[model samples]
Target: MNILLTGGTGYIGSHTAVVLAEAGHRPVLLDNLSNSSADVVDRLAQITGTRFPFIEGDIRDTALLRRVLADEGIGAVVHFAGLKAVGESVEQPLRYYDNNVGGTISLLQAMDETGVGTLVFSSSATVYGQPAYLPLDEVHPTGATNPYGRTKLHIEEMLAELAASGTNWRIACLRYFNPVGAHASGLIGEDPNGIPNNLMPYIARVAGGRLPFLNVFGDDYPTPDGTGVRDYIHVMDLAEGHRAALDFLAGSAGAGWHAFNLGTGCGYSVLDMVRAFEQASGRPVPYRIAPRRPGDVAACYAKADKAADQLAWRALRSLDDMCASTWHFQQRTAR
Candidate 1:
């Protein structure tokens, strides 16, 4: 299957491309380099030993998407294009909506035009907001707390509505908790353009001496370590989750809008990650306690049974595995 991965050069999309290639499928990568680099294609060639089709464009370009879908013979789409920083999204809600929601709308339109309906959307556990429950399930009521999350929520709603309208749109929304780690080869990994928004990469940088120290936000949270705890799934595991979603959509039984939680069902605190990363990288990750950001939760995790049962997917990597792989990539790039 020639899968069209919008934002395919980005962190998650690039990882998913490798997983798809490992599964003996061709992955067509499309990105405008808004938040990622074209160098990922070269890295992917090194990882997979096969050069994939790389399209340098945005998903908002409906005509380009239509042509890509038709010309590339894209049987399915794994949409990952969007501005994903919560703080940035709070400052620029319109850009978030236009790029995340509007780009998806255009992509769907192109898919409709090209007669391609299978899709795997990159949803987030942030849609569950503050988590009324401990382990978030697919049935959790969605009320995103921020613009970045709201964009994901709005897209999920749109996909559900499209599926409900009898469009035969086979879609699976994988609500990822926190995607960390990198490929074992260290050829491709999460290296954001500027300051890292997520925790693991921040810790990696701090350990690597690129960043001075990590800001341990609010060491008074209600957790074992009194720090914010989150379900951190490995990037490879998250990538496999996308492949599982594609497999589900390809089946005759998968015909409607389905959603699953892609997580490890285990929450790790900020300090836990720091310690683990320090151990993995053999570097001290100095940190300072900072005030907790508003709207931050004490802990957030996922049930993950739905994806395990329905999609035949599970997060197999351990926290050590996550830290080790990330450090490997950091070492590879730092040189």
Candidate 2:
């Protein structure tokens, strides 16, 4: 299948591209390089030993999307282009809506115009804000507490509505948990532009001496270690989840929208992640306890049985592997 990956140069998108290529699928990458580096294309070639066709453009360009979908013979689209930071979204809600929600609208318009209906949207666990229960399921109640999550929820709702409008759309809304780790080759990883908003990258920087120490957000959460707990899926496993989703969409018996939780189905606390990173890097990830950040849930993970049963997919990597791969990539990029 010829797949068009929006934001394909970004961290997870790049990893998914390698998986698609190895699975004998052509992945046409479309990225604006706003939050990612152009060098990722070269790194992807180094990892896959094949150069993918890449377009340096945004998803908002409906004309560009239409042209790419037509010219590349795109069978489906894996949408990943968006603003993703929670805190930044709170500070810049308009930007988040414009990029994430608006971009999806534009992409959907292009797809409708071009007769391309299959889509695998990159949703987030944040859509299920403040978990109504442990191990969030696809049926879990969703209400975003921040603009970033709201943007994802809005897009999911939009897709649901689109599917109900009598269109032959096969859509998969994969709500991803915390995605960590890097490719085993250490060629590509989560390389944020500014101060890392995610935990793994911050821990990696602290272990690599780029940062002073990690601020353990609120050691008062009602978890085993009192810090927040989250389901941290390895990037490789997350990439495989995308493959499974695409396969599911391809084999769909009817036009419908499906939602799945892509996660390891286990929660790890912030302290556990720090210890794992420290063990992996053979260095201490110094930290200081700080007040809890607003909108942080005590624990958040996935009940991934739906995906396992439906898509025949489950996360297969360990926490140690996640830390080790991330540290390896951190070291490689630091050189």
Candidate 3:
């Protein structure tokens, strides 16, 4: 399979490109480097021992997408190109909608024009909003608490409508939980452009002396340690989940859409993560308690049964593994 990965240079996408190549599939990478680096292409070649064809372009460019799809002989697409900061989305909602939602629309149009139907969309667990219950499942009530989540929810709705239109579109909407950690080689990992919006990177920076201290947001939540709990899946595990989704879509004879929650089915609080990182890096991660950010829930995790039953995919990395791998990448990049 010749798989075209949008945002293939980004953190999770880069890892998935390696996994896809290892699975005997040719991966064509398309990324504008908006939130990633061009150096990732070289690092990917180093890790995989195979140079993937990389196009420096955006997903919203329908003409480019069509040309690439045709030129690369793309059989499927794993869409991961979008703005993904929850706080930034609140400040600039239009950018999130325009880039995330608009890009998908353009990509879908290009796919339709080129007669490519299989798509693996990068959805997020934020679509579950406040989590009406513990351990969110595929059947959980869908809603968005923030603009970033809204963009993902809107894309899911669009994919649903597309599937119902009688086209033979095999769409897999993989709702990912908080993705942390890095590849074992530490050659390719997350490198957010500005101040990190996610927790693990911030903690890594703190441990590496790049940051003063972590602002432990609201250590008064209802969790055991009075902090928010979230299902943090390893990036490698998340990459493998994409592989499972692609395999399932290939084997199934259907023109419908399916949603799967890619998570470890376990929740860890902020304090727990800090402690784990300290243990992993052998350094102190200083922190100060602060008021809870808006739209933050006490706890959010996944059931992960549907993905296991259908795609035969389940997150296999531990929290310690997540912390260790992230520290490895952080230390190497800091040098």
Candidate 4:
């Protein structure tokens, strides 16, 4: 299968590109380098021992997408391009809507024009706003608390409508839990441009002495340790999920859309992550407790049964793997 991956140079997409190549599929990467680096292409080639084609552009450019789709002989697409900061989304909702939602619309239109019907979309656990229950499943009610999540929900609705239109499209909406980790090789990993928005990276930075201290957000949540708990799926496992989704789409003629929650099915608190990272990096992650972020959930993990049964995929990496791999990437990049 020739898979075209939007945002392919980004964290998860880059890992998935390696997974796809290892699984005997060709991956053509499309990225603008707005949030990622083209240097990832070389790193991927070194890791996978194969150089896949990459187009440098945005997903909203329908003309470029269509041309790439035709020229690359793309059989499927994995859409990973979007703005994903919850706080930033609140500040600039239109940018999130325009980039995330608008990008999907343009990509779909281009797919329609180019006769490409298979798509795998990157959805987020943020769609399950407050998380009514302990472990969120695909059937969990969606009420996005922020604009970034709203764009994900809206695009999911669009995909549902498109699937219902009888257009021969097969779509999979993969709702990812907290993705935190790097490639095992420590070559390519999560490299946020500025202050990190997520926990693992912040801990890594502080441990590496780049940042002074970790601000442990809200040590008084309802969880056991009074800290927010989340399911942290390794980027490698998450990447394999994409390969399974593409395999399912290529082999099945299943009509309407289907969604799977990709996670570890185990919840780990922020304190747990900090401790694990400290052990992995052999550096004390100094920290101070702070007030809870407004929209922070007390606890949120995933059931993950649907993905295992439907996609025949299960997360094989453990929390130790997650922390150790992340530390490797962090230390290497911090150099």
lDDT of 4 by residue, 158-240 (tens): 99999999758999999999998999789888886678888888898898889999887798888899998999999999999
lDDT of 1 by residue, 259-334 (tens): 8999999999999999889899899999999998755778999999989998888999999999999999999963
Ranking by lDDT: 3, 2, 1, 4
For model 3, the stretches where C-alpha displacement exceeds 4 angstroms are none
Quote the lDDT for 166 in model 3.
63
- Report backbone clashes per prediction: 0, 0, 0, 0
Clashes by residue pair, model 3: none
Each prediction's TM-score versus the true structure: 0.97, 0.98, 0.98, 0.97
Candidate 1 global TM-score = 0.97
Residue 281 of model 4 has an lDDT of 85
Of the candidates numbered 1 and 4, which has the greater lDDT value? 1
Candidate 1 Cα errors over 4 Å, as ranges: none
Off by over 4 Å in 2: none
Q: Which RMSD does model 1 reach against the true structure?
A: 1.2
What tens digits encode model 3's per-residue C-alpha lDDT throughout 189-276? 7778777889999999999998999998898888999999999999999999999999998884546898999999899999999999
lDDT of each: 0.91, 0.92, 0.92, 0.90
Candidate 2 per-residue lDDT over residues 149-249, each given as its tens digit: 99999999999999888667999999999999999999999988888899999999999999999998898877887999999999999999999999988
